[model samples]
Target: MCQDVIFHEIYSAGLLGEISLGLKRDTVEGLLGEPQDISVSSTPYILNYGSLQLSFSSNDPHATLQSIHLYFDEIVEFPHGLQLEGWLPNKSVSAEEFLIHAEHFNVVLEEDEQHTFKNPQIGFKSKADVIVVFTIEEESVKLYSIHLGKRPR
Candidate 1:
């Protein structure tokens, strides 16, 4: 579990702004207006209505948001192709659904592009995969990302 979590209104809208900065929910609302949907779990509650999916942690501060900040998984290259192991979307949306919602997406080509994952983890991959990155646009926000390719095997 995350040790320190803070909630501010602006952090939500300001995530991509500074990346070096933090966001607050109120400021997000002020900029983006309102959330389209909200998903809550044991620890994090995600606010999704626009291009941004903001997740708020419900933990204490000695470990603020940065304390447990998760580093993005790197793309690893296999012998014949590249592998995609971990990628997070901030929601439970399926790869297919996500593909449809993406304004633009691209794949990182591999040699054979025929590598098979032994198992496809719920949100992460058990094996490597084709890299994908998508950009989605919303009223006051846009999601810029690098993602894993999820085309049919």
Candidate 2:
């Protein structure tokens, strides 16, 4: 059921098939059904859809989609055929494994300049200027979530 919701990367700028960046809030809901929850405390309101969360810009009258966050709790296919799945309750992808997959896809990742030994988060700007961020767990050195969004001005 989870795998049925595939988020395909389109031109490295937005998602395709299921949802895409710049889509209106209603469009996302129409595609994914109603969200499990909605978090409106932040500027970019988040619509929680199980393991996936779509953020929409609050500044726009139409509330256009701004970003996407996917948690690696269940098996999910990422760009370049990267399939990430968790074995434990807290599913995660090892940093080394991620690097290998990224290399396979020819996706170059730049380490966060503010990254430290204790906390590491690798990020890169895609050819379409979409910012890709991997949030890694400090203790396990595993990736917990992947975020895709436009580069902030």
Candidate 3:
């Protein structure tokens, strides 16, 4: 039950909860405890913690965190009292509800035109340096994943 997870965009780089871009992997592990699993096969290694996944630049334990992915099973709260409480694989969130939630933070989601007809996800620039992505199920438009990360240079 993680609550009060703030997403800060004022700095051009966003912050989610206590984690932010360029945070050391060790620091994140200290904040969130040990991850359930770690995947090192990719360039940006992934650390899985139930509904949350953190990506780091390398496999080193101290690698800098690059991105975060939050799945909708657990309770995810934000400023202005916005909360998402989807219940894993069984429950789903409607696009309308999600949009309203995003609006609370002044986040405008634009359809990813290039992938709309195929994968169907919406995203927006959180700031000059941050990108927010919301993965939506094609037919239902149900939110599948929410990703926050630094925009590539």
TM-score of each: 0.30, 0.66, 0.68
lDDT of 3: 0.60
Which candidate, 1 or 3, would have the higher TM-score against the true structure? 3
lDDT (CA) per prediction: 0.31, 0.58, 0.60
Cα distance off (Å), candidate 3, residue 117: 3.9
Q: Lowest-scoring 10 consecutive residues by lDDT in candidate 1? A: 3-12
Name every residue pair that clashes in candidate 2. none
**TM-score between model 3 and native:** 0.68
lDDT of 1 by residue, 40-108 (tens): 562565545334344555322211122112212233211111111233343333345544433222221
Clash number by candidate, in order: 19, 0, 0
lDDT of 3 by residue, 11-57 (tens): 23365556777889888887777777888586879988876788999
Displacement of residue 59 (Cα, Å) in model 1 is 10
Candidate 1 has an lDDT of: 0.31
